[model samples]
Target: MGNTESVVVQKRLTRFRPEERPVIEGVFDRLQGGAGGPSGAPGKTPAGKTLTLEMLQSSMGSLAPDSMVRRIYQCMCRIDPGMAAPAASGKTSTPTASGVGREQLVIFLADTMRGTAEERAPLVLAMSQHGAGAAAVVTCEQVAEFLQDLISAVVQILVHRGRLQAWKPEKMGDGSLGVKLLAEQMCSELKPSDQGACDVSCLEDWIFRVSQVSLYLEMLVAEGLNVSLSSRLAPTLLPPCRETPWKELRCLLDLPVLMFLAPQLPDSYNAPWRLVFSTQLHGESFTRVVTGLTNCGPTLLLIKDTKGHVFGGFASHAWEVKPQFQGDSRCFLFTVFPRLRVYTATGYNQHFMYLNHSQQTMPNGLGMGGQHGYFGLWLDSEFGRGHSRARPKCTTYGSPQLSGEEDFTLDSMEVWAVGKPPEPEEGEEGQGKRSVLHMDPEVQAIMEMTGKTLHSQGFREPEEDQE
Candidate 1:
């Protein structure tokens, strides 16, 4: 989920589909609808007419762009074809073996929709509670919209509920309340193909894999947008965060995206990495921070905008303060909070996203340089409002067709490094042990950026390696 490599690609990654789908038309028919008549209020359906799956599906399918269609297809793919009684009666050809996921989905829906009176599915009741007017005879579009909103609301509730109930907060050795970030836990273990149990961690990882967060980031870069993290964040979220200090921010960095796109790292350089440098992008520390970066290790950059939104990039090359682009095909950009997106480095165009443009010239120009577009990260703390990007239009070397945020606000950025683990001393046979761990208060603050904590409650001395 960190700036790691992927074992699978878009083409190779497989999506499972059930051989059949439960005819859910009846489910909609079961939805309570208000009666209509000549004397009834206008814009109502006739007394017998009601919302149905066909109407909803048709309406959804009519929307532009094939992704929606594909999403519907994948959802339908989760339906169990064998659930159709006609197949058992031989009215249909032999049914293919049903997928557990598909079958489970069907049963799950059935359970959710179970009714006490047998007059309507329990889901109908649930929908009504969520504002699906019991007033019958809604339009197909209205039904479709209601269902979409319902799903969004449900997912949001489910995510935060999971966080509140199970994930306990622990005060770290530094006395800072820390909930282990799914991102840190997943750095080494997550994979796109993993179909493990649907635990919270797994659910989080799966969202990173399947969601179009990366595509959105790429579009932003392709479009040359430099805006506040909030503007960039709203679209890529799983369940949008409307309130401040969103607890889910910690998991923003947890995504199943590989940073470097081409030219894999040499075996020796592929060792695990730990956090090193982290600071606000606007401080005077900015110059020393940029100069301090070495090409000896991989670098991960995380940026937070004034709005409390966070995003970043992973560079395969050791970071350097230079006018020219450095590093391999491995560099990529990403966002953690409000959902994950990791945009990989590319060489499609002559332009490149580079770092380091000044000496005593000081923190004025864009430090994070990008391609074909004026897009890049910039911060002059004294300026009050930093620039993330504006009207970004140039396509990246990747030339992705997807669109991105054209303008955004900037607040701060964090840069971390990935390098070989410290070698064992002669007598010490394995990895070194450290009492205090993975990230610091600044690190935790970045993780908790969306939470109520404005700053990390603790700060340990810098590591010797960093010094």
Candidate 2:
């Protein structure tokens, strides 16, 4: 980095906090042969103010693979052509430039972490090019491959950092398939040309349309590169888990699906995911499913059809076993396999959620969206048969048929209670009967800190307190 570039980089560094600026600069210095090796091992340093691809890969640690690191370097070179080591003249070339400078590194970090969709779109395009030489457009296959690598990096980061929140990978379904499906689903958002090639405009449009693209990229950069960011800049990617027997659990959802769906839930940023029901554990009975689902708060119901389609719905409120429609517009229909897309209420009708059983006159089943016999998702009281029917689309949610078949056979299902359970009703038992001091120790700690009277501690019976 020359004096001119140094001044420019420092000016841009002001965008970060005073304390954080040094960390970003430290990465630049380390890559430019400052003091120690990538892993802090003492070694002879190279002489240059530039970051070679080797240095970038070494600095990225063992978590990130060569593919991701190469993309990062290519994106950096695209950001500043001057930083790229001189290439042979007149030959088609990969942006496998020898190195990039301090300015390019700083800008890459800034755009990935803080810039808007437009600013990051070019980086995505550059990365998606892979090893294509002088290719002006990227095919859909290329983009999907890029996203697969990107998502793979996110998963590795989560696993390597022990950030799974007690989720055991072995207890779940094939996560690699989930990763591939998610990548394809993300790629579906792009409007490619007749040749199935996506230009920069198509990519920019995708980045603007799908908010998840930016989020995944931001997570990859922040986590894969081990960058420290403020809480506001980098919110928790996965929700914490309430104490549950995670080891014994078998789930239909893998980490990739969880990563895709967790951020979509409203107001659940810090909420813990609680397992409410699973056919595998609780048995294949509708009564058991209902028993597990009722009054368990907002839940995500995932179902895999016999034909291998994974889809479900988000019930915004506690499911009451009644014939009448129950739930507001917050409820929605979503698909996980084949493609991942969410359909919210259109307000065309109030047919959001319905659940009933053991009734002779009324239809006894669980359904969400659309009308009777033409529901967007309907699970029969028979326990194994369900249908996701839509003539054109569901009146309420405007969603297409969710299951693989109009009437599909159930393969497996699970319900996850997201966010905190609704407050206990008056005179309710079990968890509801517990007092605030018992339920939340944070409240008790605050009272003690403020020198408040511990009346509950003194007056409450020992058994009640313990409960």
Candidate 3:
């Protein structure tokens, strides 16, 4: 009879709620005076009992700030049907689904227990994989709404934490705000596409605006402008811009001025176009000059000083070239985008004889003295020799001759600067002559014939001049 009653009691205990069953067993064991007596054992507390309320209140009080926040997040997650039941296990007395294991429920509950706002701040802004998954499952409108709320909450937190500072928008050239408010407005006004289109166009636009703001801040820093904001915000204000096709093209086309320096070119002659500047050449000087010209195209040349490195301007055949004297002497000017390759020659005979005998010895033997001579016309070779040697007596050629019938005729050639111009002599009439032009009249004429100005000195439009 005792064994049968025990079996019945066990069966009855099994029927209790999973959460309640543990407490019931404790009470039953205590009542039967098994192991611990009723007074000694922590027995089951009834729903309306003082101990039950105390236990509930204690559990609630023990929850961390993060737990509270996670509880709210779990509530948010319940939007998905699969996530709903697991989230409801905290307060419900009903039996959980077989798929919702006790361990999983405990993990969810533990996460929710850390519900304080402070604890949740970092997680809220963190781009979580789960968040991304939720975003993928949800509509873009929902995502945008969530992001907006998240950003607002973050801003509020920052403010409350005393990190908020007034940041003024950058000013444009016209003294207007440069923050691209229009883009922001568009993002706010446009409805996100619902077709799961990964058009991060809005984000891209925002990033670009931020980059511009960063640039403005850098300029301000350079100008010694005072800014109250922390320097850390500089990076935040300017994130990397997304590379669109147009941006990539712009990167390729925006050639730097340093490309014009002569030293940067390849060692051997490889450029498709050749530049023939009218200067006296002596011995093998022309070889050095040509090599220097070629070299300029490849190297990133800089003029160094104590201040810092300064970029030398790029050389191109397209710039203006005017011939000062015409006598089998024509100054070639114009720029060509050359496909260059390095020239390789084996043997000393080939290297020396090639440059000196064949190349330097112009057809008429009217070669400028070789690279070694005093009257050498090649500027690049001499410059490479450095100032340590006795300065050559050769009168350095001034700018290309601007006069003569062939003057200003344009031709397809590549131009690069090999060396810095000699410092002006004291009391010289033209103390500072920095600009050099290699004008090709042929190109100018063709451009003029086509009613386009090959080179315009001022801002006058070619069409206006034609009219």
Candidate 4:
């Protein structure tokens, strides 16, 4: 770095507020004393004091594993070479021996939370490849392993520290699988070299393109260190969740998946996620599913195929069981199991959402994207039978087949009503109520088995005789 860049890096020392400065300095001082040091000791001199890997790990609590803390300590050393304590005569200095200085810690936190993409890219590379040279190249498998550790650490912090906002992990699907899937998705974004190795240049490109990489790193540091750097960290990374029925709510998505997908939804980051339907909680009845979906506002539909392929779509509007297509361009198809990816509309066609039942001429199934019989995702009204037929790709969403096979057997499904419901008309508050009467009789039968109540019907008013 040039002299100008060096000055900018040094200026990050003042990144914390006056009040928070003491907190940061206190952390530095505590860690500098090394493990087993006196807790009430006065602040140490920043110039000579250094923090070893053991010191860093001890200060990080149990949220992050030792390996993760090692990477972070290496990152601190790499951020400023001077931070690494010089090797004594006849002694080889290892990463643990090259302790982190106060200046390095300050710049690391500042660059992670508030620095430009250019400033954080190198730090990310260092964190991912500990003890490697600045120009070291990494393979996909190496990057994936690092991501897995990072994700695991973040999930532990969220669950152990009660940061899930009342979300119950017991009611959700396997979080370990979620961690592995999310790591693969994050690794897929890396631009590897011709030899499939990710050098510093590729890492920089990735950090520039995927903003979440920086976001995750910031969260890992802030939460793992138990530091209060609110002035620098962006709170909007995970917006405030609204109230919901905690006991009744169950979901296939874990907190990490939820955190990744929540920000992707358009203008719904602050909205509540209501459990509209779930095949596990509610029996396999297409009619009951449709009834639960009506007038619930924008929703997320998730399906787990028998082959363990988990995928779904985001409905930009409330679902209505009609022959014609519904939903706006904001609608998208996504995969959750094999990997996490969202395919938006390509504008080649308008076959965004399709939900029809009981019409002989039209298809008696629910579908999204593509056209007619060749929908990107289809769920037959008969239940358990579905298909993801995308010939090269769905013209609407540009997504390929999402299920394990072209046709698949549904193992489970979930529908979450995201955000607040759209305001109803003055006299149409119970509009979706009547639509329930028109639902298939089979749905009514299975609704009992699935525990779905027909209580909405009791509130309907008798229609007066028309003129």
Maximum-lDDT candidate: 2
- Selected candidate, larger lDDT, 1 vs 3: 1
Ordering by lDDT: 2, 4, 1, 3
Residue range 209-268, candidate 1, lDDT tens digits: 432222322222212111122222333222111111223223223212222211123444
Predictions in order: lDDT: 0.33, 0.76, 0.25, 0.74
Expressed as tens digits, the lDDT of each residue in 1-467 for candidate 2 is 67766665666677788878877766676555523555465335455456667677766656666788888887776665333211222233445544566677787887787777766776787787756343567789988988988888888778888888877778877889988988988887899999898876788789989887888788777765567855435545676665455666777888888887887788643456777667776668888788767756788899999999999999888899988999998899999888888899999999999999999988999999998888999999999999999888989999998888899999999888775566666677555545699878999999999999764342221243321
Each candidate structure's TM-score, on Cα atoms with residue i matched to residue i, is 0.36, 0.83, 0.18, 0.83
lDDT of prediction 3? 0.25
Show how many residue pairs clash in every candidate, following the order shown. Answer: 30, 0, 53, 1
Candidate scoring better on TM-score of 2 and 3: 2
CA deviation > 4 Å runs, candidate 4: 1-9, 14-26, 37-48, 81-93, 130-135, 230-250, 429-467
RMSD (CA, Å), candidate 4 to true, equals 6.5
Q: RMSD to the native, candidate 2?
A: 8.2
**For model 1, what is the error of residue 396's alpha carbon versus the real structure, in angstroms, after optimal superposition?**
3.2
Better of 1 and 4 by TM-score: 4
- Model 1 lDDT at residue 269: 48
